[model samples]
Target: MNSTLPHLGFGTFRLEGQTAFDAVSMALNAGYRHIDTAQIYGNEQAVGDAIQASGVARADLFLTTKVWTEHLSRDAFIPSVKASLAKLSTEYVDLLLVHWPLNHNTVTMEDYLSSLKEAQDMGLARHIGVSNFTVAQTEQAVDILGKRVLLTNQFEVHPYLQNSKVVAKCRELDLIVTGYMPFAYGAVLKDPVIVTIAEKHGATAAQVVLAWMRQQGYVTIPSSTRQVNIDSNLKADSLELDATDLADIAALDRGHRVANPDFAPEWD
Candidate 1:
């Protein structure tokens, strides 16, 4: 499977009701061909409705969704994926991810990884990946699944919480990095440095942050419910920052993390 993904994609995490449908439709109209949704988000049907409403051909888009932690077992994984498919109104997803590493008591890593592989084999998901996994967990996955088809490791990566260790290891192993929470959960927009850079580029702070992530070769899925923000977010692909601009933004790192799950598995 190809490891390189588009630099920018639409994320549907907390969106729901007509808000999600309209936001997704705006994103599609703004030239966003990649959409991210997950079963845990409770908005797959809204996402599916928006996708269909856009009148865009399914083949023209890259759709990704995740299997919830509670559905990590071999038996549960299959039906979970089918249910996700039904909600998304699609037969196969461009990529499907294990939402989180299941706790040891719920299912062993081997069991969950095997179920993910089965989903791939059954043609429910074209490519398989994991989210919120540490570098150690990723290594374990490679050890168990081999090097054939682990396409990506999705996580909360941004200017703050740079995740340098995991990013370097993923690069060493040729695993693509998909960065979630690219804005640092609205903190990036308020940074003076990012604002200055955005002013120079005639782009918004969010656009500059997204561009920065893309320049680092990380696929970013940023969520927005506003039509204007959704449109502006897709423009991240076209904005380019020079070396100095990149350095200024990089200096904003303070190891700030916004999406830490207390009940989640240990991360390095």
Candidate 2:
């Protein structure tokens, strides 16, 4: 989520095995500079393999990985990140996140946050942040990390799931907001408003959504397995949306959320 990180990133969520390798390899070839994966994604090895095979210098890429919830225990935290570095076959990741908060009360926020700081202190992670954390939890993370900048708060942000409360809270803290599921998992493509906007710009529906997010100053990661989609997504940064277009997209909010788990904390 830093300036050095690409505004659009290639996310490897469900991608695994050879499929993961092929997709990541294609993304790299298609000019993606930011690649996101997690310890729980079960494809860091494949991703790492792709990165190595791509022949792109590590310095030219922004890599991110998450510390799974199961590794949040004080003793296991740093070790898990180190293991993730190994799986990624890299010395360090540009950003590392707490995949999911132990908000169900399994672990103290202070403890896990402290562990995240520890990873950065040791240079295992260049930056640290949280994912799927509520606004209150994000505030607590800032407090725990102290002077260290909480680089980002990755959340679901799209026309359908417009999380204005979380967005405003993050900006108030001066923390970068990274929007995952920026396309609403293909739901945005079917919206008539989006279709109309796409027609006006001579762009695809996906391009309209990505452009809106970047124009609003939020970084987005919209995953795709196809080279054409990956290349097309990178160009969304060029599509300009007018005031009427933005308002229409804003009016499409229905509070629809994806990726909610039973153990998830209260949404802000």
Please list the Cα RMSD from the true structure of every candidate, rounded to 1 decimal place. 1.6, 1.2
Q: What does candidate 2's lDDT look like per residue over 199-232, in tens digits?
A: 9999999999999998888988889888899889
Native-referenced Cα lDDT, model 2: 0.89
Q: Using Cα atoms with residue i matched to residue i, what is each candidate's TM-score against the true structure?
A: 0.96, 0.97
Q: What is the lDDT of residue 43 in candidate 1?
A: 93
Q: How close is candidate 2 to the true structure, as a TM-score?
A: 0.97
Deviation from native of the Cα of residue 198 in model 2, angstroms: 0.3
Candidate 2 displacement at residue 227 in angstroms: 1.1
Report the C-alpha lDDT of model 1 over 20-70, residue by residue, as the tens digit.
898899899989988999998999999999999999999899999999988
Candidate 2, which ten residues in sequence have the lowest lDDT sum? 141-150
Quote the lDDT for 247 in model 2. 94
Q: What is the lDDT of residue 160 in candidate 2?
A: 97
